[model samples]
Structure formats: structure tokens, C-alpha cells
Target: MEGTIFSIIPALLMLVLVLLTRKVLISLGAGIIVGALFIHDFNLFGMVKEIWFIFYEIFVSEGSLNIGNILLLSFLLLLGIMTAFLQASGGSRAFGDWMIQRVKTRKGAQLMSAVLGLIIFIDDYFNSLAVGQIARPLTDRHRVSRAKLAYFIDSTSAPVTVISPISSWGAYIIGILGGLFAANGITDIAPLEAFIKMIPFNLYALGAVLLVFVVAYFKMDIGPMRTHEQRAIKTGQLYDPNQDNIPGDLGDTFKPHENGRVFHLLTPIGVLIIATVLMMVITGINNTEGTVNILTIFANTDVNLSLFTGGLIAVLTNLLFHLQQSKPKANTMKIIIEGIKTMLPAIYILLLAWMIGSIIGTLETGEYLAGVVESASISPSLLPFLFFIIAGIMALATGTSWGTFGIMLPIAAEVTSISNMDLLLPTLAAVLAGSVFGDHCTPISDTTILSSTGAGANHIDHVLTQLPYAIIVAVAASVGYLLIGTLNQVVLPLIITFAVIIGICLLLQFLVKTKLSDE
Candidate 1:
């Protein structure tokens, strides 16, 4: 028991660091170091050896070849290359310029930004950075706050990716559910089929997206967001005047043609979308034997290759389309290199996150957590809700959804199987939803940090302002999950859950408005 407690000290330390200082990389590094100390029992030489072993395992050995991380990095790299190319060719700028010409009001600009986020449902990282880069200037011109812009970008990130089937997140869900199905004695169903079955039950992800649309369309603001919005309106300084201004200069270097052709912008994005879809299909086909198991494909296929292939297609389209005018040869190379450079920080963080997860895995922390939960003998009926809440807390505390998923999914799968509950889909959904919920609110979450960076808001400022809204949504999602688990009926439960969620949001909006007015 003492060992178990000691094993978790690193995770706890990480939480304290995030809450007190909000320095993500430092927090993550501290967690890794603490975890190593525990594993090595304060043996200085052993700790050093462990660090070397972990680094080599994660970056050089077979562990580095893990499909999920490879897929994630590949997509990020491709997104970087494509985004750079689009900026260089003036595609994103041209579209933004056209939208600016059409949208006359602040509300209109916000709506357009939300709509674009919805449409670009490829991946969370891609959505967060792309939407922020494209819409920030437009929203700024319309007097939207950096906080508000960050909120929009952050809201769209997980919410959009979670719902979209073509996204890298979708692939991960398929992989996880596939494992759950096999473990639960449902051997015949294909991975994709299992994933599709869980879609209706993914209340949080779907509900979050719906909530974003509702909030945007109704022009609702609550809590700190309300404060920030009003500040933007009164000061007329929507964009952060003190932002680093590097991306802006980078943007200027890639000025689009005077003609502002929409095709120039649409073509590359379209190619990227189509190529990614085709690659997924090919991967699915190549891995699917007569058995149709999802894990087989996840374990076998090269996800990085797929992403690289898609990115190559996108880059080629950009070069081919832009070559008709002045050759952007130097600009093309610069854009790709810049895009890759932009992703370096995220890549490094991801590497650290993976290393931490690997350490935790070696310690069998999930098994320990599961043992404690099982021994508590919590009511089986309450298991689903408890799972949802626990998963959220863990993810929030850890500040990494992928890490949360890695820790919780296997344990949740075991729990549902042992209990003989028919809540397999709900359990998986709970894990995914909870992880994302935690990621949404966590001060140290990379997604949150990226959103702040993209929106040019102070990282802590974004976390401080976004926390209330995230909490509100999380509460709603918890209730929704409870209903889905208890009611055991899909349609009626969904309706009630959505209605309650919306109602809560409305009530919160009213309270927020009243408070703002009082102030």
C-alpha cells in the first residue's frame, strides 16, 4: 500500500505544479522525475539508468514505433506542412479576407469562426491552430477578445475532433473500442462497427459540439468569459496588443495574390481531406482480414506513413496550384520548414507525455487504482457514473487525455467485463469523454496551452477564464452520462440529457449576465 501511494506521488506533484504555477513542460518533467525516483527507490544510479532506458525505449526502440503516437505526430507534421503552404500561397488569408468583406458584425465574425471550426473536423491540433490563425485577425477586426478567441479555439478542438469520424481521434476511438469488444466477449463485431455503435453514447463529445453551436448562435457568455468579452468590447483591443507578433510577421511573409481566388485556398484543403480519408480506407482494408479485428490493424498498419502520404498530396497540390503564377519555390520550402518548426514544441511535449505514460504503465498504476476501486464495492448500478467522474478527475489531474485514456481504458474494460454490465460502450465513452473533459479544463493540458498560444492569450489567463465554462459543460456531461447508463434506453435518454444540458447552460447564462450587469 505504501508502494502504491509512493507510485502516485509523481502524478500528485504534477497537479500541484499545474495549479500553482501553470507551467506544463516543467510540471510534466517534474512528474517524470518523481515517477522515476519512486520506481528506482531514490537510488541515484538506478534513476539515471531508468531515464536513459525510458528515453531510448520511447524514442529509439520498438516503443517509439507505437501506432498512436506515430499517427499523431504524422498528422501534426502534415498539418504543419499544409498550413504553411496554404499561408504561403495566401489561401487561408484569401479566404479570411473574403470573409472579412462579407461579415459586418462581431456576432457574424464569431459565427463564421465557429462554422469554420465545425467544418475542419480533421484533428484537434489542426483545428485549434488553423482556426485561431485564420480567424484571429477577423475576430480582432470585429472587436472580439483574445480570451474569447481562445475560448472558441479551445472549445472547437476536442469537441470537433471527437465527433468527426474522419479525424485521427476517430481512429483512436476505434482502436480502443475494438479492444473493449474483444475483452467483453463480443468477438464478432468489427472495430469500426463497435466504434459506430458507441457514437450515440458519446454524450460529452457530441453534447460539447452542440453546446458550442448553441452558445455561439445565441451569443451567450458566462462567468469569466463574460468579463473578458465585455472588456474586449469596452477597450476595443480584442487582439492581444502585447502578443509575441511572430506569427503575424510569418503571415505577412506569405501574402496571397491580389486576385484572391477561393479555389487556391479550397483546393489544398480539399486534397488534404480526401487524401486522409483514402489513406484511412486503405489502412483499414490492408489490415482487415476475414476476422475484422480493429486492434490488428492498429498494431500492424503504419499510421505515420498514411499521414505523410496525405501531407505530401497536400503539399503537391499547393505547389502545383500556386506555380501558375510566380513560382513560390523558396516560399514553399520556407513554409514547410516553418510549419515543422512550429510543431517541435508540441512534439517534444508529446514525447515527454508518452514517456510518463510508459513509466506509469510499468508501475501498473491502473491496476492499482482498479484494485482500490473494486475493493470499495461501490454499487454496481453506480459504476458507470463513478467511472465517468473518476476518469475525468484523473485526466484533469494528469493533464493529458491520451495518458488518461491509456491509463483508464484497460481498467474500465476490465471492470465492465467483471461486473457483467452491458455498459461497455458507455464505459468507453466515459473514458474518452472524461479524458477530453479533463483535457479541456486542465491548466497544464497541451491542448489548452496550444489554444492559448494560438490565440495569443497568456496561458494562465486562458485557463483562468476558461475553467468555469469547462466545469459547466462537464457537469452537464456527467448528468447526461448518468442518464444513459441508468435509463438503458438510447433515444429518450439522449433527448432528456440534451434538454437538461441546454437548460443548465441557459440558466448559467442568465446568472452570468446578471452578475456582469451588477459589476
Candidate 2:
């Protein structure tokens, strides 16, 4: 099954099960078991052993403790505790009350979420998690659905970070481009310059970002997203009440005070943002040799460790604020334990996602897909479009944009360099765009899961609701790539892409009627 069409069966099966049953854990577990069976040549004992090794490797890689995975898990738990602290301290309610006075409409709440997503461009993980904490209060007050908030967070995170020069995503991509340029003997442009040049040509990213604001401003809810939005507006139900095991839903574990201060929420989250950025720079400098610059710092920075440290600091700060309440001191340890309990669902899903991702990699699923793209003898004018579609499909299947980048970007570069060197940057840009687009639509994606966790949404609801919106942006961006391939330029194609997105959004808003009864 390795490096063949059969290797893709497990992913397809997982996807179909997710849509049919809406059970993330069962679907992922089934995928892992099936893929392991294929890898073990259908021997039941060998398949079980392969599954055991996959789980084992997640914690112990090459006889060493996987600090990155452990720290990332810790950060998630810490974030959950911090969320509990905010609620118990009454900070979230207080903040929502304050914002409710100013942001009187759902549109304002949604756009604010989108803008915050854009502003927090340092890392997609941080952006998705932190932005949700900050914006959830306001959005909920305005009756915005958790699914919609998750959509906003997921859509804005990777797109903004992937394009920004100072972000972790930008640093990693620039490093890859530098090596690609060096290997191809292309010296006409610097890595940073090439990255900047590629930004406009990254049609999916630009279109996705723009579409968020348009959707918010125009209430352009279509497909499954419209159903969620209408439910939110009509009955104030933010998500499907029937769904269980939703991440970030802490229930009525603690009562909030009437006089809780907004600073109770802002202060701790502020500490988290500042501390994480500082740690990133400090760690990046320590790992970097020679003269240090922003790019080198980000390229070498320990993101998982930084996130863990930041999360710890924020949790402690939140605890202090919780302690400052009236004379009666609650059982702080119990509250913390309950907070950690809320995150168990998220952690379980994340662990299963990792195991399945490992199985897919072992099966060489992405390699098989990439090989198919590489073998196609398409014309140079269709290279960008073809790469975009293939990269999207590959990322969607593997549920890892970074892994897709690792596999598809090199293949795209090699193909373009051998035929039309002029199409290199556009091809690379399309790959990045497509990877982000696909990542947005996949249930198994880490960012997708985190977005739901942050917004306190059902994971399957987030995945299904966001699919149409992502596909819309992807289609518009696909058209732009087609034009870029034909015209060999960026400006006109991007302008037309934006126009198409706006046109589609407006047409939807005008045609789709919401049957809302007056209160």
C-alpha cells in the first residue's frame, strides 16, 4: 500500500466516517487501525504492534522524550485552566458586558474577531487560541455561533501568518525558498524579496482574508454555515445542543461575581502574548549562530517551549486574579483540576490525530499523491492551477499543511525549474495557498481542532460548517491562479479575484433569505 493509490484509502475512510457519524475519535481510530493493517500486510498481531509503536513514537522518538509534543499538550491543558480561571473570576462576563456596550451588533463582533486574527500573526497556534479567548466573549454576547467563530479563527490564522514576513510560518517558508533558490542557481532575488513578491500571487491567502471581512460585513452565510448562523440568531443557541464531548465547554462549574473586573481577563491574556513573544526571541537568539536577525531568530525559535512557558505564566497570573476575589476562598486546586478536565476531550482528539497522521506518513500517502502530480505532463500555463489543486488535495488527505508544504513545494519547484523558471514563485505561492485552504477544511488538522477548542465548538460542526466557505475562497483563488498562469503577472489577477469573491458574497446575501421571527 505504501506509495500507491491504496495508501489513500484510510484517509478517505476517515473523512467519510467523520461526515457520516460526526465522531472524531472513532473515525480517527478506525483510520489508524486500517492504515496500520495495510502497513503490516493485514496481519492482526502486526497491525496491533504497528498501532502501539505509533502511539509510543509520539511520546518517545528515537529513544528521546518528545519535548515538543509534551509541551504542546501541556500548553493546551494550561489554556483550559486559564479559561476556567477567567470564568470563575467573572472576567469573561465582565469583558463581554463592557464590549456589549460598544459592539451592539453581530457584524461588529464577527469583524472584530477577524481583525484580531489578522493582528496576531506571529504563529497560527497562538493566533487561533488567544484570539478565541479574547473574542469569544463579545461574539457570544452578540449571539454569534461557536461554529462561525471557529470559522473566523481558522480562516484568518494560517492565511495571515503564512504571508507575514516576521511570523513563524513566513520564516520557515523563506528558509525553504532560500534553499530552493540556492539549489537551482537562481540568484536574481533574495529569499525575503521572493517571499514578499509571492504574497500577492498567493491568491488563496489573500482571498480568504478578504472573504472573512466580507462575510462578516454582509452576513454572507451560505450552506451549512447559514443554518448555524440562523440558529444562533433565532434562539441564541450558539451550537448544536445535541453534540457531546465538545472541547472548551466547561459547563456551570463555577459562578461568576457581578462586580468582576474586565482586567481579570485582559491582564492574564496580555501576559501570555508578551511572554510568548519574548520567549520566542530569546530562544531564537540562543539557537542562532553569527549575527542575529529577526528571520534567523524565528527560523530557530522553539515555538512549543515558548508556548508552554507563556501558558504557564498566564495560568499563574490568572490564579492570582482568582485569589483576589472576596474573603471566601474557593478550593483553587479543585477548580484547576476541573479546568484540566474540560480539556481532556481536546487532548484525546489531538493525540488520536497525531497517531493517524503518523500512520498516513508511514503509508507514504502524500508521496503517492505528489508522484501523481509530478507525472502529469501538463502545459506550463496549467502548472500553477494543477499544483494548487494537488497541494490542496494532498493537505486535505494528510491533514498537515506543513507536511504538504514539505512534499509539494519541492515537487512544484522542481517541475517549474525544469520547464518554466518564470513560474517558480507563482507555483510556490499557489502551493502555500492551497495547503492553507485544505487545512481549513479538514477535521484532523491541528489548527482546525484548536480553533474549535478555542471557540468552545463541536469539532465536526466546525469542520462541516467551514467547508463551503473555504471552498468558495479556494474556487475564487483557483480562478486567480489560472489567470496568473495565463498572464504571468500578479496585479490584475488578484484584483479580479477580490472582485469575484465580493460578487459571490453579495449575490449569496441577496438570494439566501433567513426566516427569522421577530422577538
Candidate 3:
């Protein structure tokens, strides 16, 4: 019990800080400090030394740029730079202007923005910033508050990435499934093959996407989100008290420069998508051996080179057409630099997140947590549900999906073997679902924070408004997983379960409306 308490101290500390002050960065920093202190047991010198060692291991060790951490960091940087460039070139603003020209109603703008987020299923970080930056002006023009916009963006980010097979997240999913296979003594299956099999089992991710569509198409309102949405429509005012008397605001400022064009915006993003897919295919082919497979190519290859190549191509394409037609060459450089600067805060936070994850790894918290779960001797029949719940709790507590997946994936595989279960799909699904659940609710989570920032919603406000919806979907997903496990059918039963869940929630809303009218 004492060991377990110590192991979870960082998580507890983080939650306390967040609730007390509503300062996410401070809360995360406090968690990291607590974890370090736990490692050192109040010895000041020992804590300092451990911190130094953890930092060194993360930045300088051979394992530092391992597939999971490297891919995570690479995607974040790419997103930051891409977003910055898009804004700097006036491409995003141009796109927004073009979108507004097409959509006359608030519902149409909201629906279009949601659809765009769904299409950009590359990385959650990319999805959040891109959708927020592009749709903010239009949503605001239609009197959609940043909170609602952020909610839509946040809803799409993790849900879309987990379901897509050709994303930065796909690589992580592959890695986790591979570990599960190795643990279960199933060495014959390739990682990619395992990943493919598990897709149908990822119920929560699929359900969340369905939920987003339902909410958008029907304009369903629930809890605080419903109130905010109505207020935004009626008065064009966000729920934030601080949003008074600001002129040329988030909406007004986004008016496009007269010189902006579609090519200026589309070219770089197009190049990025093409380059990423081609590189992934190239790496996958090079890494394949006879019966054995070398999955390291996903991590070991120069992801930075790929991102830089794509970004540079986009920038060049933008300058050649747009800049040459309007501004001088010097002005183009300034735009690009400014774009990069816009993503700097996200970049800094990402680096800190990586460093903190490394420190957690050093503390062996995953191993300790795994021990506790195993000792509990949970039934095999209940393993899927248990896995989902535990993974969710861990992720929520730690405020990181990557960390949750990294810790749980290997342990889940071990449990599968111990119970003589098919380890690949179920374990993968558990990790993915759990990670997303935590990412959804944890106030300290980067995705959650980014969503709030992107939408111009107060971080706490976003979390508070989003929690009940997340819970509704999560409970539905839990039932869906149980049916999947019991029925042993992959997609059909799960799909039906998801539909039923959403239907029930919508029905309840109707009932509530009828009751209110009767009263």
C-alpha cells in the first residue's frame, strides 16, 4: 500500500494543483517535481541528481529517440511549424474567408468545421490547431463561442487519430500491438498485421467519432455545453466574463489579406500529407525481413527530415506563387519566421512533456502499477472491461495518453498470456481507449489544454463542459467492449452498440424537453 501510494503521489499532486489553481502548466510542473521528490525521498541532493540523470537519459541516451517518444515529439514540432506557416502566409485566414463565403448559417459553419477536423486525421496536435485556427473566424462570425469550437476540435483530435491507419498515432498503435504479440509468445505475426486486426476492436475511438457527428448534425445540446451553444447563437457572447469590449477580436482579426490565395494555403499541407505517407510506405518496405520484421524503421528514420522537407516545400510553393504576385521576397521570410514563432509555446510545452515522461519512465511507475493490477487477480472474462477502466484511470491521473499506453501496453500483453487470451486486439483496444479517456478529461493533458487554447475557451471551462459528454461516451464504450468480448464478433455488434448508446442519450434529451414543457 505504501509503495503504491508513493508511486501515485505525482498524479495526486497534479490533480490537487489543477483543482486548486486551474493553472495547467504549474500543475504539470508540480507533478514532475513530486515524481522526482518521490524518487529521492526528500533528500534534496538526491532529488537534484535524479533530475539531472533523468534529463540526460531522455535527451542523450540511445533509447531517447525511441519510436514512441520520437514520433510524438516529431509530430508536435511538425504541427507547430505547419500551423505557424499556414497562419503567416495568410492561407488559413484565406480558407476561413472562403468557407464563410459558402456557409451563411451558424449550423452550416459548425458542420463544415467539424467535417474539416475529421478529414485531417494525421495527428491530434495538427488536428486541434489546424481546425481551431481555420474555423475560429467562421465559427465566431456565426456566433459560435470558442468553447464550442474547441469542443468540436477536441472531440475530433484523438477520436480521429486512433481510428486512422496512416497517422503518427497509427505508428504508436502498431508499436503497442507488437509488444502485446511478443509478450503472448506469438512471434509469427507482423506488427502491421496485428494493428490491422485490432482496428475493428477500437470501440471507444469509433464511438467518439459517431458521437461528434450526432452532436453536430442534430445540434444536440447537453449540460453546460448546451447552454453555451445557445448563448453563443443568441448573443455572440462566450461564457467567459473576461471577453468584454475587445475590438477586432479572434473573429474580426482573421479577415484575410487581399493577396491571399488557395495555393498559398493548400500547397504546403498537400505536400505534408503526401510526404508523410510516402515516407511511411518507404520505411515499412525497407524494414521488412523474411519472417522477421524490423519495426525500428518507424522510429529510427529521420522524421525531422521528412517534416522539414514537406514544410520547406510548402513554404517555397507559397512564396513562388503568392509572395511573388504581391509582396517582396524579404516579406515572405518574415511571414515564415512569424509562423514558426506562433508555434513556439506549443513546442516548449511539448519538450517539457517529453522530459517529464522520461522522468516517469525512470521511476518505473508502470512496472509498479502493473504489479498492483496483476496482484488483484482480475477474472479473464472481465479483463477487457477492467483493462479499459484501469487504463482510463491511469491516463486521467497522469494527464498523458502516451505515458498511459507505454505503461499499460506491455503489462496488458503479459496479462493476456497469463490468462491464455488472444492478446493482440483486445490489449490494443484497451490501451487506445484508456489513453483517449485520460486525454479527454485530464486538465493537465496537452491535447485538452491545446483544445482550450485553440478555442479561446478557459481551460477549466472546456474541461468542465466536456467531462459529462466524455463520460456518456465512455460508459457507452464500456458496454460496447463487453459485447465485443462476449459476442466475439469484431465490427457489427460494436457498431450497433455505439448507435444504441447515442440513440438512448438523444432520446433522454427529448424526454427532458417534454417534461420541461409540461412543467
Quote each prediction's TM-score: 0.79, 0.98, 0.79
Worst 10-residue lDDT window for candidate 1 reads 243-252
Model 1 ranges off by over 4 Å: 1-3, 63-85, 113-198, 223-260, 291-302, 319-324, 327-341, 398-428, 443-465, 481-496
- Tens digits of lDDT, candidate 1, 133-171: 567757876778777777878888887776555666777
Q: What is the Cα-based lDDT of residue 329 in candidate 2?
A: 33
- Clash pairs (backbone) in predicted model 3: none
Per-residue C-alpha lDDT of model 2 across residues 251-310, encoded as one tens digit per residue: 677787665789999999999999999999999999999989999999999999999999
- Total backbone collisions, model 2: 0
lDDT of 1: 0.68
Better candidate number, 1 or 2, judged by TM-score? 2
- Residue 230, model 2: lDDT of 88
What is the Å distance of residue 333 in model 3 from its true position? 7.2
lDDT of 2: 0.91
Clashes of each: 0, 0, 0
Question: What's the C-alpha lDDT at position 430 in model 1?
Answer: 77
